[model samples]
Structures are given as C-alpha cells and as structure tokens.
Target chain A: MSGRPIFTRPARLAAIVPYVWMLLLFLVPFGFVLKISLSQSALSQPPYLPTFAIAMDDAAWRAALGLLSVDSFRLLLTDNLYVLSYLRSLVVALVSTALLLAIGYPIAYGMARLPLRWQPVAMMLVIVPFWTSFLIRIYAWITILQHDGLLNQVLLALRIVAEPVVWLSTDSAMYLGMIYSYLPFMILPLYATLSKMDPALLEAANDLGASPRRAFWSITLPLSLPGVAAGWLLCFIPITGEFVIPDLLAGSESSMIGQTLWLEFFTNKDWPVASAIAIVLLLVLLTPLAIYNRLQRRQLEAR
Target chain B: MRANRLSPFNIICLTLGAAFLYLPIVILVIYSFNASRLVTVWGGWSLRWYQDLFNDSAMLAAAWMSLRVGVASATLATLLGTLAAVALARGEGFRGRGAFSGMLYAPLVMPEVITGLSLLLLFVAVNAERGFWTVTAAHTTLTMCFVAVAVQSRLSALDRGLEEAAMDLGCTPTRAFIAVTLTLIWPAIAAGWMLAFTLSLDDVVIASFATGPGSATLPIRIYSEVRLGVKPQINAVCTLIIALITVLIVTASLVSKLSRARGESAAPL
Candidate 1:
C-alpha cells in the first residue's frame, strides 16, 4: 500500500485551501448573520451598530440579552401575514413537488424503459429547458397565463371560453410556473435512479403473474423511494425561497418569504430585521433538510 | 424484447414530455416573427422583434457583459474545480478531505437567495464595490462546486491502471498524470466548463445582488424588463439563446462521444 500512489504532501495542502476558503467566505458570513440576528436592532442608527454596555455593568449585558429575546419569533408568529406567507410557501412547494412527481414519474419511467439509443435523446429533451434563462422560463409562463395570452387565445379559438381568463396574479398560475420550472429537476434524478434498477426484478414480478400496475406499485415504486426523496428535496427546498415565480405569476398579493426578505433587506434597509427574518427562514428551511439527511443516512444503513 | 419495437405508453410519454418542454420555446421562436406588438395576436409574420432586439444597444451591451463574465467565471471555476476534484478523488483518506467535500457540496444545496444575500453582506463588509468583479466572484464560487462534482464523477470512474503503468515506465508523477489521467479526463473537464458557462449565463438573483449598474448581465436585464412588463423583444432574445444552447449541447455531446470512442480504441487491452 505504501508503494501505491497516495496523496502527496503538496496535494494535501492544496486540498486544504478550498475548505479554508469556504469556511472564511461561506461559513463566516453565515455566522455573522446569526450574530446579527441575536443583536439589538439599531432602529435609531444604522441597522447594526453593535450596542455595548451603557454603564459598563453586568445589568447592561443582561439587558442586551433580554432585548434579543424571542421578540422576533413573537412578531413573526403574531403577524398573520408573515405566518400566512410561510404556510403558503410550504403549500406551494409541497403541491409543486407533488405535481412534478406526477408528471415526472411517468416520463422518467418511460425514458428508463426506452431503447438505449433513444434514452440520451429523451434526456436531452428534458434538459434542454434548463439551457435558457430560468427567469425567462418563468416569464414564458407569463405569456401563457396572462389575460389574452396564448392559452386564452387558443381557448377562445376553440370556443371553450367567451372571454380571456385571468390566470396570472393567481396562486394556480404560480403553482404552474413553479412546477414547470422544476419538473426537470424531478425527472433527472428519478430517471437516474429508475434507470439503475435491476430489470430482472421487474421481469420476475411480471413472470409471477403481477399486473403492470401491481408490479409498478410493489417493486418499482418502493425501490425508487430514494429518488423520490431526492427529487422532492431538490424541488421543495429551493421553492421555499423562490422569489421570481411568486413575483411574476402571483404578484405582490401572494408575496413569499423570499420576496419579503428581499424587500426587508433592499427596500427597507433594515439589516437586523432582515437578519432575524433570514435566521428564521434558515431554521424553517433546514428542518426538512436535516430530516431528509437523517432519513437518507438511515436508508443507506438499512441497505 | 425486439429492439425496434416501441411501447405505446413510452411513445405517448416521449411525445408529451417533449412537447411540454419545447412548446414554450417554439412559441417564443415563432412569435419573434410576429408583425404586431402584441405577442398573442396572429398577425402576418415578420422579423421585426429580432430586428428590434439587435438594434437595442442596451440588450447588446448586457449580452456582451454576460458573455465576458460567463467566460471569465467559467474559466476560473474549471481550474479551481479540477484541482479540487483531483484532491477529492485521488487524495483518499487525506486529512480534512470529507470536510472539503462537504463544503464543496454546500453551495450547491444552499438556496440562491441565501448565497446572494450572504455574499452581498460579505462584499459590503469588505468594502469591495459591487460590480463585474463581485458578480464574477459570486458566479465562480457557485459554479466551482458544480464543476468539481462533474469532474470528480469522471475521475472516480477512470481506470487507475493507466496512470500507474505510465508512472512505472519511468515518467515523473506529474508527467504521467498529464499524459494519462489528464488526457482521459479532459472530456469531463470540458463538460464541466460548458456546464459552468451555462450556469453563469443563466444566473439572475446572485447577479442582481452583486452586479453594479455598469455591469448588468443579460439575465439581470431581462429580469428587470419582465418585472416592468413583458415585451415581444424578450421572446426574440430567448429564442436566440435557446438556439445557441441547442447547438452547443449537440456539438459537445458529439465531440465527447467521438473522443471517448477513440480513447477506447487506443487503450491497452
């Protein structure tokens, strides 16, 4: 083993740079955010003045800690608008993930079962949508969903509606935009996992007199849980902080946590409040992510 | 099962999925030729929007800026990522390797808003003026992780024997790597560069935060335009971008496949 190639001293030192860079650049800023979240909001001055003990006493330190109490949490909870937005973001993410799963599963399964030569072609088609600007893709939904847009034009031509429907600035339109944007994310992972499954198991199930639906539910679906989890996590986590879809499709009336955070940071210039909001958002978003990681580890262990 | 036989279900799925993915693009392309200002109107076909898009200096400038930044960022990212991938793949059991990999993966999983906001704060704290440099820095930071992962996968799948054999033939380690490992993994590095370029081109949220007025990217410009209101010229731009990407993807895939086939034929049996 000693005679074999291993990491050279220089190579190991080089490897340490990226981690140090990440810690200084990525992790430190996050730490700063957490620190700011715990500090008192400098409403009277700049957003983060870093208050000190007025009398240089222990009571001042205690008071500073007291000021940073769960007031932000209380404010976030009591504000029905913020609470509603949080819930709405979750619902949108969940619904979008489900819709993507529904649409992506059949397409992925079909792609996986296709002739080997055509599989790459199918994958290319799925990934081509990603090549364009993401904002442009969301903007494409605006063209399709706006009043007197292409969808309405077709519907009117078909005599399905006497007038154009107001689809944009609605939650349904937001949902459609998000699912359309993220469907490829769902499909790719599902396709990757499903394609790796043993074909013999499916054949064995079929040979044992299981119908197509039964075979899919019993064998294919269970095995593809990891893919489902991965796809769901990919779609759900990002959509929680989605600003563009809600902004374009649902308008300000359906403002999401991301939009709110954007406004707080940029428009209001309230750094402490924004930091507090961001900290809470991080917690809310990371809970599911942590849970997903735990589940993935368990799944691996079980295997 | 016969090779040529196709299931009806598979056929339907393929058709529907392709249609769903491509219809918006087709619509955008077709409507770029619409004579009327209203994109929904079925007016006589013309190339007015494309002409308008070309004549618009701001759009051209934004596109140029995006191209410059994208190329710069992708180049930097590919280099950094290649080094990191080598470390992660070939430096097995090295000190702090797991932590390095985790850090590499963190940005990919983190929400863009968090990344953008965090970077914005960092830039502010450091007194670094937000502009082209900041935007390029932000893009490189995110794109490097993607490049690393792509290159690492290729490196992991590579046969170690070729490099070992080359080294055994009295070549220096670095020389053997260049002659064997690098030649074999060049395709992956190229793929990672293309992926990074595309990602940089598509970035908006982070670019919005880091970009100054003079360094607005095409996506940032397009985003501001959409926020104001959609215009047919935007469709013309989207159409051009889609066409460019399709050409690139086809070219890259064909070239990579040919190179791999050649490599397989030349490999020692």
Candidate 2:
C-alpha cells in the first residue's frame, strides 16, 4: 500500500492512453457526424464539406434546427411505405424475440437444473454457434430456406407441396434468420440467471401445494425478469438495426430502417437525410433502453 | 424427483430447437457436395462447388484480405483493451472512469449502420482514403470495446493478494504484476482476442462502408454474391468457416481446462 501512492510513469501513461484513443477515434467521429449533419451537401465532391464556425451564421443555425421540425417528421411518419416498413420490422423483431424466448427459456432452465457434470457441455452448445462467422450462419439459412433447398426438397418428397414454396425473399425467412443469429444471446444470460436460482425455493413452492405453472409464475418469472429483460434488450436492440438479414432474406423488397439508412448514405450520398433518419431511429431506440435501464436500476436497488 | 424425468414436451422442444439451430448448417454443407449450377436441383453428389470455390480468385482474395484485417485489428484491440482493463482495475481515483467505460461500451450497443455511417462521414470530411487500413481501423475501434469489457470482468474477479505478496517480497510493482497478475488473467486475454478476431471476420455492415474496391472482406463478398443469388459454393465456404471455428473453440477450451487443472494441482494444501 505504501508504494501505491507513488506515481509510476507506466501506470500514468496506461491510465490515460485508452481514453485518449477512444476520444480521438470514437467520440471524434461521432462529433464529426453531427457536424456534417448540419453542413450543406457537396455537389462536386463527396457528400459533405467542412463549414468553419465563421461560415455558420444565425440563419444557418435556424435552418439546421428547422430540419428537425414536425414537417420532416410528418414526411417520414406519413409515408405509407416507411410506416409499413417500420411496422413490419417491429412485428418481425417482436415475433422473433418471442420465438427465441420460448425456445431459449426451456433450454436454459433445463441446463440450469442439470447435474454439474453436464453443465459445461450444455454451455458449450450455447457458445459454439457464436464461434462461426455470423455471415456464414446467414448464408446457411439461404441454403435451408431457398426453393429446391433442403427444407423444400424434404417437403416436396413428402408431398407436402407439389413444388418448393418461395420461402426466401419473404418476411418469415428474415425472421428465421434474425432469430437464428441472436438466439444464443438470449440463452446465455437467461441461463446465467436461471442457474443461479435456488432449487430450495421451487421445492418449497411445490410443498405448499401450488401447481408448477403457478409456482413458475409466482416465483420463477419475477425472479428471472432481470435476465428476461437483458435477453430481450440484447435481441431487440440489434434486431432493430438489422440490415444484413433483411438484405439477404427479403432482398430488395424489404424496407427496414437500416436498409433505408444504408441507401441514404451510400447509394444516395445524402448525409443530411441519412443523419436525420439515424437521429430519429436513435432517439426511438434510446427511449426504450433508457426506460429499461431505469427499471433495472430500481430492481437492483430493491434487491 | 418424479418431475426430474424428461417430459415429452421438453424432449420435443429440445429436439426441435436443436434441429432449428443445426439443420440449416448441415443442409448447407450437404448442398456444397451437389454437382450442379442450379442450387435447387440435385444433379449428382460431387465436390465441384468446393473446386469452384477454391478456383474463384475474387472470393479467395476477399477471404485473404479478411484474414489480414481480422488478425491486425484483433491484435491491436486486445492490446489496447488489456491496457485499459489494467488501468480500470488497478488505478483508483482515475478521472472520469465511468464516462470512459461508457464511451468504450457505447459502440457495443450502437447500431452498426449508425457507426458505419458516422465513420464514413468522418472519413469523407477528412478526405481520408478508404481501403484495408480504414476497415481495420473501424473494426479495431468497435472490437476494442468488447475486448475491454471482457478483460475488465476478468480483472475484477482476480485476487490481488498474490501481487501484494510479490511486492512485499521486494519485487518491483511491474515485476509483481508480470509474475502474478498477468499469469492469472492470460486466459481472459486469449478469449478476448478470439472474440475480437471472430467479430472482425464476421463484420459486413461497417466493412461495406469503409472498404474500397478489391478490398472486400469475406462477409462483404458473400453478401454481394448472395444479392445476385444463392450458390452452393457460398455454402461450401460457410461450412469450412464453421468447421475452422469449431476446431479453434474446442482447442481453446481444452487448453484452458488443462491449465486450470495444472494450477489447482500445483497449489499447496
């Protein structure tokens, strides 16, 4: 403890380095985005031009602020296609999350209840999927879901359908891909929480003559809400901004906000428009996250 | 005790879930053996797609570029992450530690499209050239945060008493850390490195924005190809990647277990 007070040169440098690096690379880029959002789009060159402080007058500031008005919001809001896409994405994310929760919970619960000898094996199964490249997994879904693919072929041989159904380039296929990619995220945390739950509590509940379902609702569900919340947030947040799944599964017809944002930035090269879309999406996503955070804090404090 | 028996519902659910997770991968691998241009049709079982995949120069180049970027970015990220974890764990009274951690973790949750777009905007404004280096930089920036969090957790769980004992025996602080602290936390560092490597290899959204012509990563290449139509060769590539990852993970897990057993056995009772 005596030498701990002395400032070591290496210690001082290590403490400051990560923050400086993060600021320069991460935060500075974030600020640059915000700055570019306000600048006029360049016609001759790239999408953005640097506008010095002297160039930004009161009128310019007002115009920048005006871009955030109800009219722009309304334009985005009332566009039937945009609204439909948002709803479609929401439904897909919600349904996929539900499927993941349903599939993941039983596995987690079973793993948690198993003998210690089998625990590592069960955990390994959950983690092994993550080791493969994510894109490869999505590509695998294409092979399974495509016409004349494995699933369709099996169905056809069984005479379930005379021909292969067009499963790829559909919402259902996109949901399948999204859930497949994110199910592990849902399982791991749920398992962590469930494994930590005391067996005695369940035994006691059983002894009190409550049905298993009743005991589960009364004891297990509330106790595992933290993990549920965590799993949901993990799946939901990433799924909201999912571009690759929609791009691969639903093709050009999919109108996810992420794909829209991508087109704005890369294809259209409209930084301001893209920024506006991103800002809106961020605000919407952050609201639920903030609420969840607050609720989680309160839950922890109660404990 | 009676309830411990495997219920029919539980068995059904488990089987279906496992099939849902693994069948796609199995099918992809199987289709790769089909000798046909049409992905839907079964001409005959052959290794033609594997041959085709190996012969494809563009795909091969993309795979090589992805490997280079993943290795470089993961290495840089792990170093920075380990340093940051050391600071956070050992350095008390550091200014704005919470804020620093928040910024580090922020990108982990932030949408990839937003991150990619913002970084692209930054690059455009600075007139920075986009290519391999730019993609590596972007990946490093994102991967470092994940590595830092992983390392931080390991550091927090570590027992500091060993280092203190080493220092009391007249070793310098740096020597104490080298002897005790690092030895215990090396596995965590390795895990973080593996995670960072996989993430960099898998990344497509951000890579698409930052990568230039002839510098496409594996995911980007697969994505562009899939945009045209699915092919059996892509499935072949996916199967190979999955196999490689499975091998790496099993090796890492076995090594860690062996080291842990050795450590426990070496301990004096």
Candidate 3:
C-alpha cells in the first residue's frame, strides 16, 4: 500500500498524448464549425465568404463580423419545415428504439437462459450480421420491400393479397428498415447484461410463491434496466442522424434530420445554414450525449 | 422446473427473431448466384457476374484503394488507440480526465453525416484537398475510438499485481508493461485492429465527403451504382465482402473459444 503511487508522473505525461491529439483534431475542428456557422452564405468558389481571410484591417474586421450574421440560425428557428424535420427525426428515433427493445428483449432473454456452451455461438450469430456492410443490408431491405420485390412475390403466391402492395417508399417501409438495421445493437447489450445475471434471484422469487410472470416482472425486467438504457441509447443516437435508409426506402414523406442536412449542404449548397442545422442538432442532443458519457465514465471507474 | 426448458412461446419468438435477422442477407447471398441480369428474376445459377466483376477496371481500382486505406488506417489507429487505452487504464491522476475520455468515446456513436460534414468543412477551411489521405485521416480518427474501447476493457481487467511485481524487481515502467501487460492484451489488440479494418472497408458516408475524383472507395462506388438500380455486378462485390468479413469473424470467435477452453483450467475469469 505504501509503495503505490496513485498519481504517478509518467502516467500523467502519457495522458497528455490523447489530449493534445484531441485538442488539435477534435476541438479545433469544432471551433472551425462554429466559425463557419457564423459566416455568411454566398455563391462563390468556396460558396461561403471571408473564409480564413485574416489579413483584414480593424475596420474590415468589424465589417466581416457584421457580414458573418446569425441569419442562418434565425432562418432555422423561423422555418416550420426545419423544426418539424428535427421533431420527426426524434420521433422516429424514439419509436425505433422502442421497437428494437420490444423485439430484442425476448431474444436476449432466451439466449441468456440457454446452456453456457451454446452462448458464444449464439452471440456470434447476432453479431456477424451487424458487422456486415450496412449499405448492403439496406439494399437487401429494398429488394424485400419493393413493389414487385420478394415480399410481393411471396404474398401473391400465398394468396395473402390479390395484388402486390406498394410497400416500398412508405412510412411503414421506413420503420421496418430502421428496426431491421438496428436490432443487433439492441440485442448485444441486453444479452451481455442478462447473461451475467444470477439465476438464483429468479428461483427465490418463484420459491416465494410468486407466479412465473410475476417473478419475471418483479425480478427480471427491473434487473435488465441497465441493458435497456444502453440498448436504447445505442439505437436512438444514430437513428436521429440516419439518412441512407430513409432516403432509399421512403418517398417524400419522411423528413429526417440527416436527410434535411444532406439536402441543404449537397443539393442547395447552403453551407452556412447546413452548419447551423448541424450545430443546432448537436445542442439538442447534448443532454443524451452527456448522460451517455457519464454512464460510460461510471462504468470505467466502477472497475 | 418446466420453466428451464424452452417454452413454446419463447421458441416462436426466437425462431421469428432469428429469421428476421438472417433471412434478408441469406436471400441476398442466394440471389447473388442467380444467372439473371435482373435482381427479381430467378434464372439458373452461374458465375458470370463474378467474371464480369474481375474484368471491370474501375471497380478493381476502387477495391485496391479501399484495401490500401483499410490497412494503413487500421495500423495507425491500432497504435494510437493502444496508447490512448494505456493512458486511460494505467494512468494516474490527470486533470480533465473525464473530458478527455469523453472526446475519445463520443465519436464512436456520433452521426456519420455530421462527422463527415464537419471534417469536410475543416479540410475546406484549411484548403486541404479531399482525397485518399483525407479519407484515411477521417477513418483513422473514427476507428481509433473503437480500438481504444476494446483495448481499454482488456487492460482494465488485467491484474495490477503482476505489473507491480515487475516494477518491484529492477524493471522500469515501460519495460514492465512490455514484458507483463502486453503479452496478455495482445490478442485483444489484434482483434481491435481487425475490427477497425472491416469498419473502414465497409464505410461509405464519410468517404463520400472526403474522397475526390479517381479516389472512390469500394463502398462509394457501390453506393453510386446501387442508387440507380441494384446491379448484378454489385451483388458479386457484396458477396465477396460478406465472405471476407464472415471469415474474419468466424476465425476470431474460434480463437477466443480455443483460448478460453485452455485458459479456463489455468486461471479464473
């Protein structure tokens, strides 16, 4: 105990390495983003004015600052479409997280209850699909959900419907695609938490004359809260910024935050406004992001 | 009790869930072998698309470019990530450690579109041309965080006593780490490297913003081609990518299983 140097000098120096890299690469780039957001939009070579033109006199500096208006932000606030798109993305993300948890919890519970020898292979099966190219998976969905696609062919053959329904480019299709793509993220964590749980607690609950369902509700669900939180955060964060799936699967109905941001930057070339939307998006997500970091930090320190 | 057995309710849920997860990709793999030019039709099986893919020069270049980026970035990311993990797992008191850790972990789940846009803007502001190096930089930046997570978990689980004993004996801190700690965490580090490689190989959104003309990565090429229609050529490419990733994952799992089976008798988890 006496030999332990908790705050060693070598370790402190080692800590500086990542900080310096983050300061230069991570923080400075974010500062650049803030500066660009404050800049004015224009139709020029760079499509935004006064970019790193630091040679201005004091008088020119004021003029440049004045020109670097908050109009992009103002426009974002005033526009109903922008506001609704943000809300829509949030709604979709939350709903998708819910769907993932509902479907994933049972599978995770089942896998966790299986014999120990089969657990590793079962976990691998869940993960291999997740590790595959995300784009290819989305393509697979498109093929399945298209009007004359696989789903339609099967339904027609089975006489489930008289004709092939228009399943692609609809809200239902978008939701299905989102859940399919993100289900693994939900299952992995839930399984991790559930599989490590003590079986005796449930046995005790049952031995105390509680029904099996009551024991599950009283013991199992509450116990898996950590997994549920982790799984929810994992699915929610990325879905808010999801673009490719919605763009591919939905018609003009779904206006996700990522889709709006992409259109502003790529199609409209509105760099200032696009940056503003991104900055606003970050601010909105700041709470969940902080909570996520805190949760991770607590986990790290708990060990 | 009967509850320990697989109930019919759970059996149904497990089967449906498994089918939902696997059926799409399974069908895609099956369709990749179809002789029909159209994705919808099921003609006799043939390897014509695979042969056609081999003869396509543009795709060949994109594949080569993606390979180069994956290898280079995964190497650098593994090095830097291991260092960062060392700092986190072994480092003592340091100011702003919480915030520093946040920076490392935040990007793992950050929206790819936002990251792509922000990094592209940074490049434009600095007047750096977007191309291979930029894509590599973006990818390395992203993958390093994942690598750090893997290595950090392993390092944290390591026994402090072994390293302390080495330090007690005449070994310096660096030498102690190299001799005692590195050997234990080496497999985890290698797995993280492979994970980073697959991540970079499959990335498209970030590479889209970061790439310039004649430097399209394989995913970017595939994205453009798949946008107009799902061509059979892309099917061939996607099948190959799946095969490669599947092989890597199976091999990694097998290694872990073998190591665990042997180590279980020797040490407790």
Candidate 4:
C-alpha cells in the first residue's frame, strides 16, 4: 500500500494554521469592536465600561450582557452631527464613484486598444502611482491646490483667471483628490475586462455597418458591466469611509463619518461612539460587498 | 482592426488621463529640489530639503521603525498568505471553506477605520501592549489578505499536471509541491511580498489607530507633519520614496524580461 492519505498530515496542518490565525486576529476583533460598541463611554483605562470576561460564569455573563446598552447607536440617530455626516459620506461616495466611472472608462478603453507591447507599459504606469505613498500623494495636492500654487500660477499666466483661485480647502479640490487617488482602482479592473474582449466581435460589428458609438453602446458597454460593478464597489466602499482626502483637502466644515470617528476616538476619547460609527459603516457597506462577492464566486465557478 | 487601431478620441483620452494621473506627483518631485523656502517659487534646483531630511532625527527614527515593521510584517504575511492560497486552491471540500474565503476577502473591502478600530479594541480587551508589535500584527493581518489574493490567482492559473507528475515519480505530496508548485508560483509569492511591504510602508490610518505613543511609523509621522502643513522636508522624503520604488520596479521588469529571453533561447537547445 502506498499509505498516502488524500489529506496529508502536513497539508491539513498548513490549512489549519492560516484558518486559526485568521479566526483569532481577523474575525475575533470584530466581535470585540461589536462588544465595545454596545458599552458606555467612560473615564477608564480602556475607555469603556462593562467589559466582558470569557471566564465569567453563565450568570455573570448574563449580567454583563444586561449592562450592555445601545445608547451609542441611539446617539448616532439623535445627533445631527452623526446623522448628517453619514449622509454627507454617502453622498460623497456616490458622486466620487460616478465621477470615477466616467473618467476611468475612456482611459481603460484606450489602454485595451493599445498594441500588445504597450499594454503592459500602460498598466505599469497606472500601478506605479498606486505603489507610491498614499499620504504623500494626498499631500502633493495641497501643494498644487494652494491659493498661490502651480495650478493658480498656470491659470493666471494663461489669463484663465484674474487672480489666484482659492482651490485648497474647497470641495472642488477634495473631489479632485478623491478622483485622482481612486482612479487607478477604477481603471485597473475596467482594463482587465476590456482587454479580454475579442477583436473579432468589433470587426463583425464594423462589417455589419454599425457605427462605433452604436457598437460601444450595444456591445462594449454591456460586456463591461461586470468590470463597472467591480470598479464601483472598489471605489465606493472605501470612499464612504475615507478619512484622508476629506481631512486633508476638504474644508473644515465638511466632516465625513471617518473624520467623525477619528475625532471621537482620538480627540474626545469616546470609544463607544467611534465603535458605533464603525459598526454602522460596516452595515452600510455589507449589501454592495455581498453583491460583489456573489459576482466573484460566479465568475470563479464559471472558470 | 478598427477597434485595435487608436483613434484621435482614444489618444486624447489617454493623454489627458495620463496627465491627470501623473502631473501632481511630477510637480511635487520638481518642487522637492526648490532652494527657496516658499514651495511655489521654483528656487532653481537645489537639494536643500533633501539635506534637511537627513538631519531630522524624529523622521529618521520613524523611517527606521517603518522599515523594521515593513520587513517583519511582509515576511509574516507572505508565509501565511502563501499557505492560505495553496489551501484554498488545492484543498477541495474542506470544512468551512466558504467561511475561510469570506474571511480572506472581507478585509479587502472593509474600511481601514473599521479594521483599525476593531483591532485596537481587541488588543485593549486582551491587555496586550499597543506598540510596535501590535502595529506589526495589524499590518500583517490586513496585508496578508492582499498577498493571498495575488498568490491565489497565480495558483489557480498554474497547471496541476506538473505537480501530479512529480508525485507519480515517487515524490511525496510535500516534495511534489516544493519541487513543482512552489517553484512555479515563486514569482507570485515574491510579488505578493513586495505588495505587502509597500502596503505596510504606505499605511497611515491603520498604523495611526494601532500605534502607541512611541511607535509611530514613517507614514504616521508624515501625516502628522502634513496636518500642520506641507513641509519641504516631507516633500523630499516623498520624492526619495517615489524614486526608490521606480528604480526597484524598473530593475525587476528588466531582470524578468532578460530571464525570459534567456529561458526562450535555452529551451531550443
């Protein structure tokens, strides 16, 4: 007998190692966040009350559960600051994602149509900026969008404006940063799908006398929907909770939920409130993420 | 053929998009060498900011810590992530496979603030010290998911026949994987490691949440300084990072291409 098992001992151990590690570090932390979210903010070492002990007996466990309250979430509902910031974040995410789609589609199409040798080069160009420091990229904008910065200098020299434009600390500058930072995320996925299209399909359309625009609408756009969906989720989900761009480039008055959570946790030391914001943000993101997962699984199965 | 050919419209889109993507960082690089104190004045090409960057002790210390964290986390993440990828790609009908993959992909879409907050809370609950180790653990947990995805794609695309042949030749399962599968997927694993390292280096929000008072990374330091305003020294640091990454990537591609050419020529012999 060969005596070789289907699931070898080492294979089982290897799989279990990562599974257990993820269970401990990745999955368990959310439970802690959830528990803290239901607790009261207080003046303490850990900054929350009614911390749960796994060693507690059933009665003590029940008692701890009873002490947990939803006041933090209630505050999220009642506080104009929390509610408005959530709405603002949603609006910003939606607008920015739509802008990404509009701007990314043409560029990705152009990339896909490039010669085989140039395609990889174009892809690398998109990725190089992505590899650069995210903080530095955002900071780079502050230099250009400042009132007397290079953008204004160029605008003034061209007589596009009578004076230097007040670009920094404006929503316009904030959106510019958002679009610039997230554009690669949008383009990469779109290019993946676009580049895989059969040129014969477009050739057939051209032979049938369909206009390029007509072919794009009837064929290209329909085929690229999956990429559009992928890109949409990629950009929209994180942008909803974006802390950096809005914090750095947006006006002080435009407080998104991410900044709110940051201030709550760091400045005010309100861990409960911050946890509530995180939980709610996760809840808001779950639907799209589920859809994305389903789509990915289907693609995997098809493969 | 029409679709393959570049039209004027496509050319314009490519040009404009490239400009939009690249212009800001290029301008920032140019400004890094400005001799004048004012950032916009274009003070005639000096390395004053780069010189000051060398002398800033806090920034230097933070950079050192970041390098340490990047190496540690990237190594850990690569090992775990490669294992996870192999298991998912090859181990069919494993229990909790659905849940395993869910855990793998969830972090990719999960917001950084949520991840950071949750991890910090967990550390606090466990009474673990919130310092360099905690930050490394957090970065490893997050970046490993990216590594897993990258490696998994490569693994799934690999021909399993090679490993099966090795096994048929009396190699053990582990030896077959080592000689065939691991060798084939080495590039993906290396790419995954680099991706994880850069991600650990670039992360600010997660590090900020996970970090203690004295364990700030380079991005965290740059972030705090940036909040105060754009400084020439920070620009110089950013320029150096960009240049370093560009050089590494170019060299990697050149080496890969040369090796590919050599392999093609050798195969005919």
* Residues A1-303, model 1: lDDT tens digits: 122544254455557656665676677778767666566556654366455445668877776666665555667778887788788878888888889999999889888888889888888888878766677778787888778789998999999999988898888888888888898989988998888888778789889999978988998899998889888887888888888788888856667888877887778876766676777878888776665555543432232
**DockQ for all candidate structures vs. native:** 0.44, 0.48, 0.54, 0.58
Name the runs in model 3 displaced over 4 angstroms.
A1-3, A6-11, B1-5, B255-269
* Candidate 2, A135-186: lDDT as tens digits: 8888888877877677888898899999879998898888788888998889
Lowest lDDT 10-residue stretch of candidate 2 chain B: B1-10
Error of 3 at B39 (Å): 1.0
lDDT of 3: 0.83
- Give the CA lDDT, 0 to 100, for residue A38 in model 3: 84
Error of 4 at A60 (Å): 5.3
RMSD of each: 3.6, 3.7, 2.4, 2.5
Name the DockQ score for candidate 2: 0.48
Sort by DockQ, top down from the best = 4, 3, 2, 1
Best by DockQ: 4
Q: Give lDDT tens digits, candidate 4, residues B1-269.
A: 22459998999999999888888899899999989898888779899898898899999999999999999999999999999887777775568877887888878877889999999988888888988899999999999889988898887887676777777888988888897778667777887888898899999999998889988899999999988887788889999888877776676677667655765686444
Query: Which residues of candidate 1, in runs, are more than 4 Å off?
Result: A1-3, A7-11, A39-47, A51-74, A291-303, B1-6
TM-score of each: 0.91, 0.90, 0.95, 0.96
lDDT of 2 at A174: 84
Q: Which ten residues in a row have the lowest lDDT in candidate 1 chain B?
A: B1-10
lDDT tens digits, residue span A1-303, model 4? 122355345555677878988999988988988888899988988888887777889998888788899999999999899999999999999999999999999999999988888898899989988888788889898998888888899999999999888988888888999999999999999999999888788878989999989999998999999999999998898899999899999999869999999999999999999999999999999998788777665655454
Candidate 2 off by > 4 Å: A1-13, A53-87, A251-254, A291-303, B1-8, B43-45
